[model samples]
Target: MAIIPFNKPYLTGKETAYICQAVESGKISGNGGFTKKCQAFFEKRYGFKKCLLTTSCTDALEMAAILCNIQPGDEVIVPSYTFVSSALAFIRQGAKIVFADSYFDNPNIDADKIEQLITSKTKVIVPVHYAGVACNMDKIMEIAGKYGLFVVEDAAQAIDSYYKERPLGSIGHFAAFSFHETKNVISGEGGMLVINDEQFINRAEIIWEKGTNRAEFFRGEVNKYGWVDTGSSFLPSEIVAAFLYAQLENLDEIQKKRKEIWNYYKCLISNTIENYQLPTIPYFATNNAHMFYLICPDLSFRTKLLQKFKDNEVLAVFHYLSLHKSSYYKDKHDGRELPNADKYSDCLVRLPLYYELSDKQVEYIVSLLNY
Candidate 1:
């Protein structure tokens, strides 16, 4: 039996061609031709004020932390059900992570619960677009505006997803996107920091260029590059940009295939809701088909279903373990209890979702669910 893996990175052949051109053109370093091409592509496509490629989404997040002036003792509101990068990025910058609760249906931070946790020390609100589903950005933004807080979107899974026809990354003051192999786009390990606010563009470039006026020097705006502020080596090699440009060029095709698989799963199991609850898509959000997950009745049922998949040579898996429940953050958790986030952390099971998934494989996977 052929084992169906949970995720597979898809690539278009344009990489080698671009990489060859990059090498032949004699500039295969950071912020070279391929890198600039990707930056321009993302900025034009997403309406980002500025976009900088980084070594990883984690790096982009750290840059955002610095740009936002996250300081020691400053509280940043984030969901406890998201990837550790969402909280740890700020935590590394000496900000205290104020863990929030998840929404009832998705892993996104519940916007309704944000205000009650606010304090004079609160500085930023990090919202992860879990499973490529948009959170209630309007509610989140309104709260941020009212409280004078910065909104940083942890849009690692939301490259092609949208919120109210506006692109996900453009809605927040700063947004971090991943190009890791597991994401819709693949460069093995890469990320982008998007600046939506105009005021942050110059500083963002400086942060990406290791605190030097290198970007200005390259543009002839500065006679020579000079160190100006504290920064790190966040830029990726041209090889990563080469691979990523290929994926970005084929973004529509990849998204088309993934959506087909996602819809197929939804159609196959839609009728099964009488026995098991299926994944719910909010009417307000347009998803990018990043992941297709189902909600079992309980944690035990989800675990059993996963075992059944393992027995059948299908690599089904569960998503995140709520961050608040982790040993590192247990003491840091807010006193308020979050039943929905806890329930989702226990019951959600993500099935295999990738661009190359065939219709026959989809049918076989769904058929096993009926057993």
Candidate 2:
């Protein structure tokens, strides 16, 4: 039996050529030619206000934290069903996390409950776009406006996704995207911080340049670069940016292939499966094919399905454990219970859906699951 992975990165034939060009250009450092190309590509492609590539989504989120002025005792709202970096970035800036409950049908934070969690100290609302499906951004923005809070979208899985015709990353005050190997696009490990608010662009450039006004200096806007503020080395090497440029160039093709496989799985198993639910497409959200998942009957059933996949030389996997229930956060959770988050975290199973996966393979996997 062939081993089908939970996810696999695809290379679009241009990676080696671009890397060689970068090497020959004698600018293999950060913010080189290739990096500029990638940044420009994103700015034009997504209509982002200002896009700056970072070493990883973790770094981009950290940049958002800085831009939002996250401080000690400040509170930030986040969903418990997302990756730790989604919340930990702000937490590292000394903000207290207020874990939000997930929507009944999706892992995104419930927008209706957001207003109830806002307090005087609530500084930001971080919404994670789980599995490429957008959260209710309109409601979130309304709530933020009412409370004077910042919105930082964790759009790691939502590169090509849209919410009511607005691009996912462009809707938030600040947005972070991932180009990790497992994502629809691959840069081995890379990310981008998108600033929609004009006020954040200057400071964000300084933050990306290790607390220096070096970017302005490079562009001849300043005579000399000096230490401006607190920052870190968040930029990636030119090599990674070169690879990412190749991926960006092929974004449409990559998304198309992934969607094909996702649709195949849905069509093959929708009629045969029982006690399991296929991923839903809300009327307001457009797909980017970031993930294809199923809701199992329970935690035990999810585990059994994963083991069954393993036995068949496939690698379907489960998602996060609710952050609120984790030992690290449970004691400090202030007695809040995220019931919906807890339920999805325990029962969600993600099947393999990658750009290079074949339709026949998807059918075979779905057939096995039905069996």
TM-score of each: 0.97, 0.98
RMSD to truth, every model = 1.2, 0.9
- lDDT by residue for model 1 (161-253), tens: 888888999898999999989999989999999999999999999988889989999899989999998899999989889989999999999
- The TM-score between candidate 1 and the true structure equals 0.97
Candidate 2, run of 10 with poorest lDDT:
362-371
lDDT of 2 by residue, 1-371 (tens): 58998878788999999999999999898999999999898788779999999999999999999999998999999999999999889989999889999977888889999999988999999999999898999999999998899999999999889999999999999999999988999899999999999999999999999999999999999999999998999999999999999988898888888888878777777877888877877788988888889998888988888888899988998889999888887887878878889888889988898877887788778866764
Candidate 2: segments with Cα more than 4 A from true spot: none
Candidate 1, number of clashes: 0
